[model samples]
Target: MRLVIAKCSVDYVGRLKAHLPLAVRLLLVKADGSVLVHSDGGSYKPLNWMSPPATLRIVSPDDVELEDGVISQWIVKSTKADEQLIINIYEELHESSHDLGVDPGLIKDGVEADLQRLLAEQIELLGVGFTLIRREYFTAIGPVDILARDSAGATVAIELKRRGDIDGVEQLTRYLELLNRDPLLAPVRGIFAAQQIKPQAKTLANDRGIECKTLDYDAMRGVDDSASRLF
Candidate 1:
């Protein structure tokens, strides 16, 4: 990553046009071939950014710009789109680069794994007579988060998420399709479980015949499950 603090102006040209007047702001030139212009304020969101698969070139300012005290320009071109972000540089206050290697990726603050474990230990939260079959029930595509059986002995595939979205619902649908093909687990049903589910996701789950269940993480955590586990 290359970080620069400079007094510059920015202009974006593409499907939309945007401009940022001259000011001392931070410029981030990432190793991924993307560039971001950020001011000190807007939380984590960048003031302007070019997505990856882009190129950046530093070229001397034009005669008119030079006469106006502009020194150079950083031109960023998106390889995947018609987007362009140009930064007009007046002066660089600081600049540095660093090599940040591999990233393990982000885990949700509430922890999806904990949610899975908690739900597994409290399977009855799903319904009155539901009992857990197993956690991480393996299937052809991937492991279903939780597998359980209702009072009638019908298999139920549950996909748990911290914040449920349409993708989670689709994932559960795929699991159901695969599980139902097995004679032993035939007539498998699906339950999309999450702490909070989006309205659009809930609607999609209902349309797909998958029940949506909102979980109360705090309530579940309050219950001691140490004795319930075989560990």
Candidate 2:
């Protein structure tokens, strides 16, 4: 799957329109260990200022796994909604392959972990940091696909898409809310990186301070290299 990282809301909206019927879920994860899922035809009506948690999973932390189709969809979704979020930290390690200064095998290991090692390596060279936080609730809502953090410790959320969904911002808004309330997290910031976003929804993000960005997965393999160098 390809990925594109855009810088603004307008682009995201346009791309979303070009894609539709996105067979994905919208997930909401809380810092207190709560998980919620909102897949197609799932009810998402908020009650008393909050939505209730859907089916909860009982799985070990280190034993994280996903079925194949879901994983593909997740990779696409995460690449769009949260570029920095899904990228694993190991991808940022710097090592030279040919001179044996760095083991090529190690780089391969990073990839096996689903870390964008090259992207991580480049971003670190540019002085940025990233870590992936797996939240079960997001998987329930739909799938977070990707969640990222910058060097200064800001959150950048991405939702990957092969087609557009109308609830992109709404889904991201929930994640943002959860992130902002976390005491252990650095100051939270959010961006909805989508193949597209709804028009009025863009206005809502603007009115509320959330940034909406667009991605062109077909044009890029992963997150943009610019964010690492735009000093």
lDDT of 2 by residue, 122-182 (tens): 3332224655443222432344445566666666655433333446666766666655443
In model 1, the number of clashes is 0
> What lDDT does each candidate get?
0.84, 0.39
Q: After superposition, which runs of candidate 2 have C-alpha atoms over 4 Å from their true positions? A: 1-143, 163-166, 222-231
RMSD of each: 12.9, 19.0
For lDDT, the strongest prediction is 1
Please report, as a residue range, the 10-residue window in candidate 1 with the lowest summed lDDT. 61-70
Q: What are the per-residue Cα lDDT tens digits for candidate 1 across 1-231?
A: 999999999999976699999999999887778788889996545687776668998888553344266788888997866779989999999999999996554444556899999999989898889999998886535578899999999989999999999989888876786566455687899999998999999999999999999987877898645566687
In terms of lDDT, model 1 sits at: 0.84
